[model samples]
Every structure is written in structure tokens, then in C-alpha cells.
Target: MTISFSELDFLKPELGAEFTGDGVHFAVFSAHAEQVDLCLFSPDGKEETARMPLPKREGDIWSGYVAGLRPGTVYGYRAHGPYDPSAGHRFNPNKLLLDPYAKQVMGELAWDDALYGYRIGAAEEDMSFDERDSAPFMVKGVVQDPNFDWDGDLAIRRPWTDTIIYEAHVRGMTMLHPDVPENLRGTFLGMCSDPIIDHLTKLGITAVEVLPIQYFPDDRYLLEKGLRNYWGYQTLGFFAPQPRFMAGDRITEFKTMVKRFHAAGIEVIMDVVYNHTAEGSERGPTLSFRGLDNLSYYRLSPDDKRHSYDTTGTGNTLNVAHPMVLRMVLDSLRYWVGVMHVDGFRFDLASTLGRTRHVEFDRDGGFFDAIRQDPVLAGVKLIAEPWDVGDGGYQVGGFPHPFREWNDKYRDDVRRYWKGDEGMIACVSQRLTGSAVQFNHSDRGATTSINLLSAHDGFTLADTVSYDGKHNEANGEDNQDGHSANHSHNMGWEGPTDDDGINTARARRRRNMMATLLLSQGVPMILGGDELANSQGGNNNAYCQDNEIGWTDWSGRDDPFVDFCGRMIAFRKQHGCLRPERFLNGDNEGPREIAWFGEDGAPMDEEAWGQAGRRMVVLYLAKVGTNGDTGKILDQLLIVFNAGGECELRLPAVNGAQAWTRVLDTGAQAPFEPVAAEETVKVPGECVLAFQSAS
Candidate 1:
């Protein structure tokens, strides 16, 4: 039943007659506002002068029923209240605003003083009120008619232990693909095409964790600098999909992409940033949240109402401790899961969601508890970045159960060990084994540690070994924007070098790092372009780079590094013993499944762990079964590493193993050959090697 705009009456409504149809039911939650007006635009978008005041005001919510206004109708709201910033009220009846519950927003906002509730250059800036009608400068929300046929597509809830996550950007992944059509290059359809699916399937990753797809404003600052927000962290609308990613049809294209991915036996996880909105601060524009109800939606300083509590460092953090704000987040998550068919979400700056009015991390915060007890959300994956810029914000391994955390310790230790930082044997061993000391408590299994070496926010694997410091002059920030503590060592020279010795060392280090990440006992997450040795020319923070530096360049298809990535991923999937659900201990059910050995083929000594200049060796031995069936082993893998200048590794002999075959040699050149079983191979220095023992 589609109602036409003429049949709808906003001045009065028949309460008993249930409006059981897809029409526009305008509603705005403004606690301080006295009245609200609904303004509708025409079809051709020339004359928009129709206005109707809301008939009912229940508590702070102003709602009215519009009968004939169906989907695709553009509309904005104007709330009437006192325009005083010192009293925490920045409302102006003439200024138009976007609804916080809008499912779809049309048009981009033009930057101008008319969009702000106060004059820009006034002496009291934001404190001086302006009487400008912002209907022309604001984006109008569309009343969408939601319907889609899933065709038996379901979320593949792969177990946490066997899951391999691949972090990628939706646009950057397929923007350069030759197979995707030129018209659909950066759209949702492009990512769901054969080229992208084939690459993900071949890599053996169970999940593709994409960056932010929510509607975000292309910042005015980025435009001024001739750059883009390539990462999509600055969100404008929490519920609506970004219009730029939609092609042909708008919302249906996003649903089709999710359905296609699910049909391919892969799960989709979204990287969501609910910590803050695009409305920067007091001086920022009057976007949705700030104009709706600034005091209710944002966390203001307790003593000083003029300032906001900015734990997210991206301006005002959302006040999730508020009941209504918590409901908004939970509603959005459930809508995405049940309606949009998303598998999970990775929260950006998740610590901010768990903070209270006191600015302390509460385990049972309103936002966290609401999602935990929900029947629909409890079944899906929940990952946390686990930190903010506030005091005591670094809660690396301090999250509760049912929440996996990004293990920064694993990343730091892996870089230090492979870069030849001595006296790191103990820390390296702990990281390789899933950092059991950090996650073993509170019933969180080994999979709780989402191990990753390089992510979208930092340097790629190739850049980490090539440059010691970030050269971000290309960002136009005078090389002062990115991180200062890189934890990188440039073998001998910085950046690219003509010296063969230095280039060879850099290549070996990339392979070694990839091998370690896949072989580690945890849920491994691979950065999208790291496999192809993608470099940003030593730019650690390329959040604003949308060119070749950010996109996946397929021109290097014939490069040896591309083949190395495929081989390393295959090795991890073929070996079930590498990714264990439980931590390994010397005294488990029977004999030790994992045994660490020193250079002498014996248990490592404490002295070797403390030596500042010594680069030690480790041997991983897995016993097949429990007590009696231990002798009937399936296969044993030996991983040897020589980080020092050169060393001769004495291979450990297994009791029932028939022969040892060399499967991987990181130091070899193009078209590497595998040695036959029982062959005594020579291992090179500063390289990693892997062998399979079969009976």
C-alpha cells in the first residue's frame, strides 16, 4: 500500500487507524526543542516550500504521520528552540538538519556559513547565533523501501580457531583490477565480481574484513589539500551505506554484494567507527548529532559544559553511557546483521564505547552489556581495537570474554625479532605461541589474539624493512603527521638502494615475516596488499592517499613476491597443527606437543634468552595423539630461523619419522626447488626454512 503525498496530513492523525504501509513517518528526538517542522522537496527538486508542523510531542520526541510520502521522497527537519550555546542549546528554527535515524541521505553538503547555526567570524564564534535557513546547504534524508531476496544465502560462521581474516578496503581492492568493468571499478559490484572472489578463494582466507562503508563526509580539509579520506574513518551517517560505493541501483547493490560473497563461502566483516561523528567539535559544522541534541548525544566535560570529553581524539566521543545513545548503536548493529546480512563488526577505538561519564573503562558499560545480552548480536563476531587517546586507554589484553582483540604485542615482538633486535627470545617465543600469558586467562581461548604484523594504519611489510623513518612529505603535512616510533631498521641504507646485498636482505626479511605470521598459533589477519609487497614509499599513515600508493597495483603480477604470498598461505591452510584452538604446554594430556629447541638440538637455556648479541634457534615438534597413539604420528613440521650473521643448525631427529623434505626456503631465488626427503639441505644465514617429516 503506497500512500501518495497529497493523502498524508501532518497537522492531525487518526491514532486508532494503524499506518501499516511503507510511507514516511517523520520522527525527531530533540529533548530541548519545543516544536519541529517537516519540510518536503518536490520530485524535480526545484521548489521546496511545503512545511508541516508535527502534531504530537511525546516527551522529547516529535513525530507525525505522512500518508502518501513513499520511498525516494527527499525531506529535512527544522527544530525550534533557544539558540544559546552557553546554556548548551545551539538550536535554530531556520537551520535545516538531517535526521539521526535516516536510512539514506541524498546530496552532499556544500561548505558555507549558512549551514552553521552561528556566524563563522563572530567574536564569540558558535556563541553568536545566526538566522540563516540551511535547507539548501543540508543533505535531505530519503524514506527508503527496504526489500531484498537473499536466495538461501547465509552467513558462514567459521570457527574462530580455523579462521584466517583478510583486511582490505572495498574500493582499493578492485579499483585497479583489469577484469572488473571500467564503469563498476570502485562500486560494490566490482568487489563481488570474479576477479576479487578468485583472489580471496586462492588465498584460503575465510573472512574478508573490509574498511568503513558507512556514509562519511569527504572532509573540507582533505579537499583543500587535494586528497581524499581513503580509509573512510570519518563517518557521517551510521546506518546508511556510502552513496559513492553504490552503482546502478543504490541500496540494493550493497545487499547484492553481500549475497554474492556469502554464496562464495566467505564471510564479510565491517570495520565500524562509532566512537565519533564527522561533526568535529564546537567550531565544526552543525551536522546531524550536534544539531539534534548536543548535550544528549555527546559527552561534555562535567565541570565545564563548554568543552567536550574527547577520548577518541577525533573530537567529541558519542555518549554511549546514555540509554538512547546505546539503543542507537545496538539498533544499527542488529539492522546490519539481520537486514543487511553482515557477519560481524570490528569496532574502531572500541575503548571509547566502554567508557562511562566518569571517564573510566567499565566492563559492564551500557553499550557493551546491551550487545552482549542481545540474542541476535551474541552469535556474531565482535572484535575491539581496545584503546583510545584518554588516560589508561591502552587495554591490550584486558577485554572480557566473547571479544577478540588486536594483539599489538605480537606485532611489536615479531618486528623486533626479525629485524635482529637481540635479547628478545623470550618475548618472541610468547608471541609465536599466541601470547598465552596475555589471553590465557578469563576463558578466552588462543583465538582471542588476532595476530597481525602490519595493518592499514601502518607501514607495509616491504616498507618496514626498507625504511627506518616515515617520509610523508607526499601527504603535504611537512612530514609531521605520521608516527615517530617506527621500530624499523634499514639494513644499511634508507629507502631503495642499488646495492644488491641490501635488496637481497630486504626480500629475505619480507618472506621471513610472512612465514612467521602464518605459522603463528592464533587467528592470523593478513593486510590486503602486503602479500604483493605493496609499499607506500615509506608513508606509514596513508589515510588520505587514494592513488596508486593506496590501491592494489596488479602490474606486479610476475613478481616473485606475489608467488611467495600464495605459497605461504597454502602452507598454513594445509597444516592443521599450526593453528591450534588451545595453548600448548609441556604437560598437557601426555608428552609436550610443541618443544622449543636451541642450536644444540636441546631445550633452550635461560642464558641464551638473556644474551644481547646471540640470535637463538627454535624447533617445533608436535606429537600426533594422546598417550598410547603418540607413536602413530601423521606429520611433523620443523621451522628453523637464523637471524644472526651465519650459523649451522643441527636438525632434531624424530622417533617415527621416515624422511624430511624441504618445502620452503626463504633465501632461494626465482623458481625455487624443493629437496627430496632425507636430504641434508644447507640453510642460509638471516633466513627461515620449513621442512615436512613424513612416515
Candidate 2:
């Protein structure tokens, strides 16, 4: 099946190296390159086999076919052009670049001065060009076979009302899992193993929002300190999965994991970082995008094109405003959804993506409009971090319809209220109702708010009540890195204490917060390992800790707390009133579907809501309305929250309800039976209780 070089086809439309049975077709986008050469390497990816210049150029793409090249061919690209940094065109023929559309990347990026386009000690810095070859230090792209046996696997598009996201790291999830095999641990195969799937199913998780699996490089500074980027936020190649996460050098391992998850009725949601790349500012290495078309790929400074317009706080931000760059991002997304079988994506630093060419955030930006109209992407779940470190970038509830945003407001206000902060009752109420003040417009539903208590960037749920201040000295940042205003309380002691009373208080606090997250009128996202009471030893920012501090400690899990979380999830699923499709309000409508009450068993007045010292509040949810005649009425639920000292609260009486069964009590940690509607129950401090009406 070998063909000669004269039989090469120069009209291939697809980018990257695609195998076509008899040979491989190479196509790349480099708008500024004077010449693009396809550099081929040996089977071991060490020695250069051949360097052939692409024979054809149509628009910005350079394409050519290499006869007799097989699926396992190792290749890279070298663009020869001007190295003028001031005008933002950095093209170095010595530095081999990775294909932006590469599906399979091989080898680790060895940090060396040779990888950079400039000399390390040059006084001119990035402005001076170096003639050293970057092939030995750079990573190479491998031609991949895109065929996979899906085995009748389709997407599990669970509705937003029923989706419970579990944010997990592909490696940190199963790294310390006892049941996982040694060889499979910290890999894609281990994440969807039998034990992991069983645990998620029992916990009632519908989707797993996995952290970045895209190909990224380890930071030189972190590696110098003997640490690694445990959280893969720095993306190098969007189309390629992280090579380390695969047990073997095969892209099909990720598909296998997805197939297994689908078999268990679980959806895979990737946390994608498209706002920036691993290549830093102008001084950074000439990696894939930086060397290809610097001016076209990055948002360079309007004043000085040598510098980057960094809205992501990362050194460089992707210039998605450009048509070609936008196409690349959209293409990467479609490739993931169409070929990888992933069900959703949580865009990291999404505000950067929503920014217009003028550097201001726009809800109707090109990125949003393009994805909203995309046929393949519109059906998949889209979640956004909703903000970046740029100016006016904190867009918590500012996203459009069908796009859910991570609600940091919910996390902070919930933490403050549970920590006994004054004047938080009002703020907590807004969060409980899905932050209606923020996201109630534009026909958006209550589930637009992705409610979360703790995530990967901050302290774990167990540490939230165990550490009053961040302990991030291990991050090599001198304890000055993570947020100082944590809005956290250490109960009576800091860190892990030997006292039983403090441990009990911490456990109760975790339960209260977890219950609040699940019972609220929004989509709940449980930080993975929170159910087992996982801790990072008070280190809120363990982004560089690849050791035990980052991995989930399965052996030291609290079995009782795990059971409590599982029960809470199951309870949330059983009751549809908790996750309402529409926002609940008391406008004196027909039958009054929802009502708020104070501790006195009466309707909450304006004075009660404005109380600075009020910590006890009641929520009454009923399905009664015009639909009652159609037999669509559901059982009513009464939820009570007591964040202050122990107090007695009289239960509110509802129509056609005789007895109320206490299904959940977060404080007592024990079983409870039914109580009458008129009975006054004593609620423990920092507790959450939910009662179901039995007619």
C-alpha cells in the first residue's frame, strides 16, 4: 500500500497529520510563515528522518501528503519567517512546533533554554533570536488512528434539574484508590474503573466534571522546586489528551473510559482551558501557537505588539477574536464532542473567551454566538467559570441561556452565613433561591447557577471548618498566595485537633453546607472527595502538590460522613421540589406554591428578613396550584436552617398534611421518626433539617 512522493495530494482539507491508508496528509495553519516544513522523526522520536516543505498553500493552511508514511509516524512543524518581536511576528525555523490539531502527542517537554526562541542571557531578551535547534527539547506529534468501537454508546444528556456534578481530577481521583490496580492508577483507565464507577453510582452522581485532560506542560518554576502542576490548568494542545493520563501511548484509552462511564449511565464533562496556553508572554518559549502565528494567535498589546494582552492573568490570552483562531477553538470543541464522546465542557476562565476585540466582556461575543449556533455543541452541557483576573471580569450570573455559570456568590455567602457572620441571612436567602437577583432575567432557569461550596483552587470541605487561615506555605509562595479572606471559621481549634468536640463540630458543619448545596434551587456541584472528608492539611492552594496532599486519601475516609453525603444526594434526587425548573416566589399566586417563614412559625416579614442577627430561617415548598386538578401535585417539603446557637422552631402547618417525616437531620447524625406539624422541634447549632409532608 505504498505510494511515491509524486502521488502526493496537496488539497487535504483537514488540519494535522491524518493517515490515509497509503500515506499521511499533513496540514497546518500558519498565516505568517514564509515556508512551512513537515519534519519527520525516526520511530523512537529522537533522530530527524526527513524534512519536506509543504507543497501547497491555500489561504492560511499549508498542506502536503507524504507517501508511505504510516499511522505511527512522528512529525512536527518548522516555520521560517521574520523573527521581529516588536511587530509580533516570531517565526523561528530552529524551534520545532507542535500541531494545534494534533490528536496524539508524544514525549514530555524537557525544560531547556534551547526550547526558547531567544537566548537565555541575551540583554535583548525575547527581541534577540537564537539559532539553536529546539527539536531535542520539544514534544512531537504522532499520527493517530481516529477509529474507535463505540459499541452503541451515546451521550447521557441528563437534564440540568437532575444532574449532580462531581468535580474530580483524573489522576488525583484514583491515585490513592486502594481497589485500583497499581499500573492503572492516576490514568484515564483507572478513573472509570469498576470501583470508581461503583462509588460514583452509590453517591448518586449523574456527571463527572473532570479537570483538564488536555495536553499541558509542567511549569519550569514548579519543577525547579521539585513540585508539579497537580491541577492541569495550563493547556498546550486542546485536541490531545494529557499523555501522562493514558496508561499506554494510545488515544483510544480515553474513549474506553468514556464508553465505560456511559455504560454506568454517567456522563463525562471536561474542564477545558481555552482562554490561554502554556506559552507565556513574549519572553516565554516559542511553543506550538506562539511560533506558528504569534500576532494572529494571541492578543498582543495594542501599544507594544511585543507584549501580550493578558486578561487571564496567565502570561498570554488566546486571540479568539481572529477568525482563524476562533475556528481553531471551535474545531477543537467539535472534535472533542464528535470524536471523543464527551457529554459536556466546563470552560475555565470563560470571561476571557467572552471578551470582544476591544477587550471588554460581552455576552454576545463571537465565542458565545459561535457555540450557541453550533449544531454539535448546542446539545452538550456548557458550564463556565464565568470570570478571570481581568478588569470587570467577575460575571457570576451574566452568562446567556443554556450556559450555566459557576456561582462563587453562592459559595462565599453560604460560608459566611454558616460561619456566624452578621447580616448574612439576606445574602444566604438570595443564594438559596438560585440568586434570582443575578440570574432571573433573559428566560434563564434556576439551574443556571452551578452551586458549589469548595473546589480545586481552595480548601476542601473538611478544611473549611478546620482552618481559619490558608496554609499554603508548601506552595513555595511564602503563605501569601491563596486568598486571605477565606470567610472561614476554625470552630474552636485550627487544623486537625485531637479534641472530639471540635471534630464533631467540623463534621456537622460539613453536613450543613453539603445539605444546603443540594437542597437549594440550583444545580449542585460536589467537590470530589468531599464525601469521604478528604483534607489537604489546611493547604487551600495545593495546585503544585502532586503528593498525598493532593491525592484523595481513601484509607482515612470517614465512613459515616460518606453515608451522610450519599443519603443527602439520594434525597435531593427523590424530591423534585429541591431542584425546581423555575424560580419559586410568593406573589400571592394561586395556592401559594412557596413561602418563607421565620422561627416564630409565621410568614417572614420585611423586618425579619432585614434582621442582622437572624440565623434561623424556614422554607416551605408545595406543588399545589392549578395543576392539582390534573393529579400532578407532588409531596410538599419543609426545610429549616439554624446557623446560630441551638434554638426551638415551631413547624408550619400545611393544608391536607397530617404528619411530617424527618428525612434528614444534619446535626444529630442519628435516625429520626416522624413529628406532628404543630410540634416544636429543637434544632442543634449549625444544622439543616428537611421534613416531608405525609398526607
Candidate 3:
């Protein structure tokens, strides 16, 4: 039931294919195009039925309306202009382009020479043009019906102080899940299945920071090596959810996942890659952006004008400095929040997004200012992977207010301290207090640091204690892909070993790391599958391992460690002093809300902190008065972290409290017995012990 354009009708300025009950309005932005043709494909996308040139040009937007068009109409675009690469205009009508604002991208991209603008393997390289019809190979956009039965679902805007982010991969989380239906596995629906929801709820996770699920393609190079891109960081389309993650054609599957997560009181935070696109470089294929307006879409080299200004390490950095490109990014974010109903975003390579035209990372840049002032975006949680592979891009605490950053310092220092590194006690103390030296400015609270021991980019918690180095030979990169200095220590053995002592030591180290993450005065982010003690067989960089190597193996799970992590998360939630609303600065004139002590139970002086070999510290936290109450201790907690040999730690006396109840010990199993306050407690090496004040 599709009809071609009867006559050229005025299309609205709204980007993408907008179904208007009677017709579909197609619009796209191309600053320097001689002609823009709207190619309508068959329902099966096997044939291009009509190729009508957009009859209207409103500024940079080319648009037209086709009457009697339905929501499922498949389409693509072809911009005709100069094919001069040296001049930075790679326009080839032969290569069909995907809509940047496409809500649903249909068909798998068939990687062939026909998909490229220039002749492949030619002597002239990109200078020679190819007129092959790429419509037969390109993925087309679908006019999706935006209506969905939300069923009264609302965003769970959990405050930063209460947020416990569980970083997960949509497919990795449920691909091999025993409970998810076989047909639903690796899809959006599977990620929000009852079993997965129950697991997250039980683990006390407030939000699931899902890895990039936006429309991305399998790298041609990886496919050649019989591997696939499992991380989904190479985003192709910002507005379209990955077709691989959908069980069916409907884009509503993503919405359904969000709805279900909201029902379980868990927020959905998307890991977005807006800094770059899958289109590699000037030598890359002429995809949507390059074909439409190469100069306008990409930051080309100021000197060469042909090569891209690559700051993201991924060939080309998106020209977000351009108003049209910036608008597209902002619009995409708003669509995710308003239409898709996602609660937050974790911007991948966020430092690149803050780069201005001069290519320097600006804290108050256009991207940050736009998002901070945006009413819709300002309310949502914004987490930044605050560093890029560019110069001056390591902006850990450089983001403005209302934005939290991934604190790698916290990760490195915590791992080093627990790995028995000398001179790490001082840095570990700073990390435990939320790295106040880094994030204390601009009135930002302690929760501004998203503390993590491990993430998708590095070794899993289990592997961190088992592998001394990265085992990425499987990634086809000669074992030199991942980080060289992982700050990891193998407990007397590399990789999995049969020795019971090594296994026991690895278990204790895992517990200690998890305990430190929960006890820190910042938002804790548990790398998904760490609770189950999941291991990648020491493959720190599994970005290309789509098989069992990357998937979370639920079969060989560490049940005891799972229980320990869950209980630790519960303990963190129950105590307010561990995750305070403000920095735990003890310099105030009033009673101290936090204090660091040595094993002798005396307040740690400057001399004690300067000890290079010391690896044990006692953290005393007072629940500061809130809601207009006087700044006084409402409740208190004492946590002991021992990274060295076994020692007796003397307990501290509270103001009015008589005894302290030992609630948690990473060295022992749950159901801990209460101990007297006046007695000395034995803390083993690499163990964490928490005690609550009791009357």
C-alpha cells in the first residue's frame, strides 16, 4: 500500500521520514549538494521502486512529501555533487546513504566495493570515482511508527547519591542466560526479561549502564578474521537501535526494554558514541555523512583538507562544532530520552565531544553548554568517559556540574593498593574519600566520581587477580591490543590454576576490591558479570570476541561470590555515611564527619600518611545531619582495610554508643557475629571489615 510522489508537496523541516497519517515527509541535511534524491525501496528492500529528487530546499535541508506512504516504507538517500576528495566533497549518487535521523535501519550492510564512493584497489585510490549501484548493497532506513503502549512507565530518576550502576552489555548479559527464551537471547527483550530484572533487583543495582546498542556494523577487518565487534562502540546511526539487538522488525523492542527496567525500579542508561562514526576515514567508504556533506560532517585536517581531523582514534572525529551536526547530536539525545524513554547516557569518549573548532577540550564548550541548558537533558543522568586518545583529552574531573566522570584514578589506586603496591596507601585513602583532590571543585559532590575496579575495556575482576598481563591474542592483534599496565597481580599463578591456595587468594582479592568499591564515598559501578566471578579467560580486550569468550557464562558462575557482592551492595545502600551527599572534608570547626586512622585506632597524622610501605587504614564515618538538622553525628561506621599481613586492629570509642557490631567481613561468609567494642579484632591480609555503632 505504498504510492510514489504524485506531485512535489511541501515537506516540513523535521529530519528523517515522518509519517503524517496521509503521507511520509522525507528530509535530510546536506550543506553542499547539487541534488538530493529520495530513493523508495520495495517492502522487502530488494528493489528501488522510485527515485524522486526532493523538490524543495529549505536552507541546508532537502525535503519532499510522498502521498499514501505507510510507516514501513523502506528508503535511503543519494546526494549528487562533486566527487572531489582532495577538496573534501565525497559525493557519489551511486552509493546509497542511510538517513542520519533514521529510527529503524533495515537490511544488513553488504560490505563490497560497490558500497564505496571511489574505485577500490585503483592506482589513484580515492581520487578515482566508482559509479556502481550501491542501493543493492546498502542498508535502507524504515519509516517506523512511533506509537508504543508504554503502559504507564515512568523514569526512575534515582539520585546520584543512591545510584549503583551495573555496567552491562545488552547481548553479553543474556546471550547465554539460562532463563531467557532462546528466541529472545541477544535481543533487547532478553536484556529486560524477568530473570535478568530479578538478578539486577536482587543485586541492588539502581541503574544498568548498557553498552552501545546504537546501530553499528561489524568491522570489515574483524569479519575477515572471523571475529565480530561485540562492544558496539563504532556507532553508525545515533537514533536507530542496532538491528542485531531486535528480535523483530519493530523498533519498539527498545522501548519495551526500557519500560520493563523502569517497572523493576532500575534506570536505563545508554552508553553513547557521538564523538565518531563507523565510517573510518577519507580512505573509508562513502556512507551517509561522507556522501551527504563530508566537509560539514567531519572535522577535516586544516592543512590537507582531504584527510579527517581524527581525535577519537577512530579515523574521523565528528564535526560537532558545526551547528547542523551539533543539532543532530542534541536531537538524537532528546529522542532517546523523550521517545525511547531512556533515563540517562554514558557518553563514550566524552572529552572529544567537548572539543571546539580549535580541537581543544573545553569544559564549557558548546556540547556541554547545550546539554546543561537543555531542559530535557539536564534532568537525566549524564556520565562521561572523560578521556579520549587526543592531546589534552584526559579530563577526569574536567566536566562541569550535573555530570559525573569515570574516575580511572580511583580504579588504578584501588587496584594498586590491594595488589600490595607500596606507596599506594596515601592515594588509596584519597580514593576512599571519593578522590576529593580531583572532583572537589565547582561545588560538585563526592558522587561526581563513578568508581570502578574493572570495566568492559579491561580485565574482569576475576581475571584481574588471575592474569598478570592481557591475553588478547584471540583478538587477532598479536596480544598487543589492550592496556599494558593493568595494575593487576596474579596470586602465584597466571590464568586459571588447579592450586587451591591460589584460588582462595584470588577469591579474597575479589572480595576486597568489591568491598572497597562499595565502601568508597562515590557512586559505585560494578562491571556486569563480576558478581558471578565471570572471566574472559584473561582476554582483557574482548571487543571482537562475539562467541563464548565475550558472553557472560552463567553456567560456571561463582555462587558464593555472587552472594557476597549482593550482600555488599545491600550493606552500601543501608549506610548513608558510606555514600554521603557532600565531600567528607574533616576541616570544619564542628565535630568531624570522617577521619582516617592507623591500626592503632589513633587519628592518622601527616607522618603516618607519609609511610610508603603502610597498606592498612581504618575509615571512621559519621552520618552527617541532613534535612536542616544540626551538623552532628546521627550514626557512625568504622571500616578497616588491610592489604598486608594479618594484624590486630583496636576499635575506636564512640560518643554515646557503647559497643560496635561487626556486620561484614570480606574474609568470612555472611551472618557475622557481633564483636565487643573494647576488644581487638584480627584482620587478615587483603580483607575488609565493616562495623556499625551499637548502643
lDDT of each: 0.78, 0.88, 0.90
lDDT of 1 at 90: 71
Residue pairs in candidate 1 whose N, alpha carbon or C atoms collide under 3 angstroms: 3-68, 4-68, 5-68
Q: Given candidate 2, what's the lDDT at residue 575?
A: 82
Ranking by lDDT: 3, 2, 1
lDDT of 3 at 50: 86
TM-score of structure candidate 3: 0.98
Better of 2 and 3 by lDDT: 3
In model 1, the runs with Cα more than 4 Å from the true position are 1-22, 44-49, 497-499, 621-635, 653-659, 669-681
Candidate 1 lands at a TM-score of 0.93
Tens-digit lDDT string for candidate 2 (26-133): 889988899998888887789888887888889999888877778888889999889989999999999999999989889999999988999989998888889999
Q: All candidates' TM-scores?
A: 0.93, 0.98, 0.98
Off by over 4 Å in 2: 1-10, 624-632, 655-658, 671-678
Model 3, total clashes? 0
| Per-residue C-alpha lDDT of model 1 across residues 226-318, encoded as one tens digit per residue | 988889998877778887787764787888889988888889999999898888777777867777788788887777655677999887788
